[model samples]
Target chain A: MNKNEIDNANKYLSKFARLTRNVLDEKELISLSQEKTLLDDYLQMEQLRFGFKYEINHSEDLDLENIEIPSMLLQPFVENAVKHGISKKATDGKINITFIKKANDLALTVTDNGNGFDTEKKNNGLGLLLSESRVALLNSIYKENRFTLAIQSATNGTKVSLTLSDWL
Target chain B: MRAILIDDEISNLENLRTLLEKHCPKVTIMATAQSVSAAVDAIEKYLPDLVFLDIQMGEQTGFDVLKLLPRRNFEVIFVTAYDQYGIQAVKFAALDYLLKPIDIEELINAVNKAEYKLATQIQTSQLDFLLQQLKKTDTHVSTIAIQMQSETRYVTLSEIIRCEADNTYTYFFLANSEKILVSKSLKEYADLLRPNGFLRTHQSHLVNPKYVKSWLKEDGGILLLTSGEKIPVSKPNKETVKQALQRQ
Candidate 1:
């Protein structure tokens, strides 16, 4: 491999190592920064695998240090966007993640300019199914602060958003 | 009920046959085909009440077979091994599907649903919708099917003004001054409608930006619609609401 490719390989390995460590940590809830790092590593690995055919964008306020969320809550949606949405596009695949604070809640959204799935279908991808169940389980544990998931899909793209009520 | 099975893989077809014979006794396998042409021929000859279609089959797809047919006179339950594009298309049309290594429970459920549709002789609107969706180069559909107690309502997306949550129920307000109360949760509709220009302004409210008249700064925040109805906007959603309105 060329020098640049070799550098990417090393970076990929490091990110993979970090993800493996985080996955095995056995924590049900993680800090926002930890979740952000996990997503960053995961997205980097995916981008490396795809030769960086897609772009990543973020819109956020820097108030994420204190909040905690269910472990790996955001990964599945991002994974889904890449695997289903971005993978099929010919060019200019974009993934946008937003982290904003609203009143007593924290709003998180992951959007992709890829082929969108049917939000109306119950039998969608396994990642989404598992995340839904995870959120439900989390809701049972955290009685006061409920985590709500909303997904919108069109031919152009799909957006998955989550609201953590009273989380702020 | 008579059924036809279509898949390029002999093993998959055989496995499905065995499953149907063992579990779904009411379904008789009338024909099985290994290609698009073969599947079309089988469907034409047997005129089965149901068909199990595999999404990917060499150069041609299951959709190609359906396209060859004149009209849908039977129920369809797609079977595939996690083909994302095929699955999404099938789902966008709101049809039944079972992933490969199919769960017996899911298989049975699909079979039962097909059976129910067959018995009712429900107009194949979903199949028609699927066919229409396949004809389009783009992904967006103009209408959403809302299942109510007595019937399913196909409401145009543009006509919807707002949706309100009532515990487990959702109330859809239309531009024509008609309100629809659906049994499903508001969160579900919010998710389904978000990409179609709907904004969730509060825990209980989802508003279509096209119908939004103004964002009132009073009462913490409230949105006025073209119908002169007011919707409360929560503090967190104020910026989002402003941005959405500004975009409009």
Candidate 2:
């Protein structure tokens, strides 16, 4: 193979290895700080590839540093924010990942400035199905049924939010 | 036979030229282009008999190359990386293509097929068919283009009720009770129209699941459609028919 081809192959392999590490780390509980760091790094990698911007919102009084929770719980939704929203967008694609302290639960949202599609469609894609199943599984693990995932899509943009009670 | 080679990759273009020179001696290399603009220039200047095309070319695609063309008197043999949707659309359109990295046998076969097609001129309106297929690959069943003797007919999938196969020809039974005979085989339409509520209940019949009103279990299962047409469901196809109804 040529030098260019070899370099390209190595670049792809390193990227694949990093993602494989994430999948392997899915077995453990990831803290809020770890989750933020992981997703932020992921957003950076995607920015290098697709030239999209990522934003995060949090407050100082949240006390969200070391609380352990499910691993890779928010990856699917965040992935959708890029695939559906950012990729389809022609210019200035931006994604916002927010963690708001709700009254009884912690609400996490992944919002994208992308042209949205119909959420009611049966065969939208497997990403939504996988995310729904992951939420259902996470809900069963908790003591109460305090987990919810909502998807709202329109021409303006798309916002997907998940609420986890007692998650704080 | 003269041909134009279009690919963004210099290596792939060189490889194809070498392969063509070695295997297909009849096809003379007229020109080589690296992008859609260069391809258009070559196509206009040479007006080659066949054009070997790559689907992806930097910011432009093989479809974009076709879009800028002034004429399509030449045949095309698409060469693309393995793309599920793109390949499916090409198959539905019944166009010739060679997959990458190019295989010697597939390359020769594609070139020979294109040569035969160009010589015989069996089907005249391929570019229109290709454009329709590209448009259809993005959405659910909206409209289908059927080739007529001297022209093309576009009909919404909802208007068609059933399709009957008679040897090589297909008879489309529309909602208006008019039967249009198309020269294409039924199997081609079966794959294209299957997702759009069309079911192959019998070897000779393809019926729309929405038009089916009832099915009688006696005498090897006969479906009574809303049009009062009795379509036989073979024993082997009973499970298929049941599953199709359950999906509805």
Tens digits of per-residue lDDT, candidate 1, B200-224, equal 7876788988888887889778998
Error of 1 at B5 (Å): 2.1
**Interface RMSD list for the candidates:** 13.5, 23.8
Q: Write candidate 2's Cα lDDT for B1-248 as tens digits.
A: 89999999999898888778878999999999998889999999999999999988887788778878868888889988644436655655556777676657668888987887767765556566667667654565466667565545667778889998775678999999989998766755775687677887765688988899998887768999999999988544566688788878
Best by DockQ: 1
Off by over 4 Å in 2: A1-168, B103-105, B121-123, B132-138, B145-189, B202-205, B226-229, B235-240, B246-248
- Give all TM-scores, in the order shown: 0.57, 0.50
Chain B TM-score of candidate number 1: 0.82
Reported per model, the fraction of native interface contacts reproduced equals 0.00, 0.00
Q: How high is the lDDT of residue B196 in model 1?
A: 73
Candidate that would win on lDDT: 1
Q: Each prediction's Cα lDDT score? A: 0.77, 0.76
